[model samples]
Target: MKVLRNLIAIGLVFLVILSSGCSIKSTNENVPSSSNLTVKMLDVGQGDAFLIKTSQQVILLDTGDIDARDLLVNKLKAEGITKIDKLIITHPHADHLGGAMGVLMNFDVKSVYDNGQITTTSTYRKYIKKVTDSKIPYKQLLAGEHLEFGDGIKFIVYSPTKRMIDTEEDLNNNSIVGKLKYGDFSILFTGDSESAIEKELLNKYKDELKSTILKSPHHGSKTSSNNAYLKAISPECVLISVGAGNDYKHPHETTLNKYKKLNFKIYRTDFDGTVTITSDGHGYNVLKEKVQ
Candidate 1:
């Protein structure tokens, strides 16, 4: 009996150590919403930015590119967003986090969340300094975690697992991938994560990955949106945040063909100034600035 107890104690300790790497944390306070949830894929030339508005909070997903901070700020101001409740920077890539300083400089940010990746770029340095100097509450997001999105909507984070972030040098794959869940309506936000991470998510989440919509991975780049992974998510609609006449030629043809084959409704910020989706928990309606 003594031997069995010793072995059980050791196994329990091992399990605790294994699970401590990444955790699923939830806040005790939840402010349930009485209105619809809104997500806008703002058009920021040559980069990406998404604004999510719950009834009680406003969340900025990405900050576009370094050169396009004005456009990002102007667009937000045009939308009457004076303050941001949460700023979630997916990765430290130039295009994704370049305008982070602009956001920090222009708005009242309540808190910040990121994947805990680091880069030596000046833009990153400036952005981090601003966050630190401002004394904003900052937290690192990892797989298996949850963030409250206000009014019962929550973000179920699924990527940049501590193991992967430590082992994988690719910042794109380390991008934070999360699914915004609001009742029956949900959309997966892929922060430029590539095929390998998508496959990992497939194996981990499986059927749970199915979402009503997918914020097309990697801005519709061919390097992402793996066929098997797409089949697993089975998104009815795909939203791509790419810039017009981009040198990188994003929203590649191969990805479009795949979406077509699957008959998923497609919307792109390049064609549509800003694509917004409003969900009332049970259903959703998409509204865009213009038609292509």
Candidate 2:
């Protein structure tokens, strides 16, 4: 009887240890592997181009305009960036896909991601060809997809779902929107999506739309920054990527007024030059080339 009781006690102890070990393994898999990250929104004239750097890899969000290709290449080289681990293009528009060729030619890009919208333009055709010819891994990002931006960073895609892409009938409305989250800090990258899509996001995300920073939609076009959308996001600051004297006259006064009403800080590439942000998962700081 004594021997049987001893065996039963040992078995219970072993079972508890086994269960605890399994739980720990699963928890570790979900935890971020790193803690430091940097995002640089370049001052590419009249366009968008952001560089994300982590200890494990570098990500290029957009490539700016066709005419700005050389300058973009020069800037990357100056920063000692010879390789890009991931190149995420929001859509096939000229300003977004134009510098793709230059990037592919000058840097070793390992993978590419875009909205998968084909267009009838030489620029789009050539850009696709370059991506294919170089044998880089290519994929289309749809809503709900998650990307691991190494160093404890995660990017949650919120727009350009396959359903939206097939039905929107407009490229701008299908622009890739995503939230880059590191610890408690997050930045909402809006691409060039305008009003209609903004409404969809506002309805779907609701309170989840809030972030620490917002990359102003469509360069702060009056077509976007709707009251409901702005209220949903409620970012502490907003950044606009536009040329100093752009023909489009982006960042319309109406949009500025909306940001002001919300008491959100505004920064523009035209006036502030490059905007760089660094984070340590728990907190972050925003730095600009100029006061604006």
lDDT of 1 by residue, 218-273 (tens): 88899999999999999888999888888888999999999999988888888877
lDDT of 2 by residue, 9-115 (tens): 99999999986654211111123344478888888898999999888989999999999999899988988999999999998888888899999999999999999
How much does candidate 2 score in TM-score? 0.87
Candidate 2 Cα outliers beyond 4 Å, as residue runs? 1-35
Backbone clashes for every candidate come to: 2, 0
In terms of lDDT, the poorest run of 10 residues in model 2 is 23-32
Name the candidate that leads on lDDT: 1
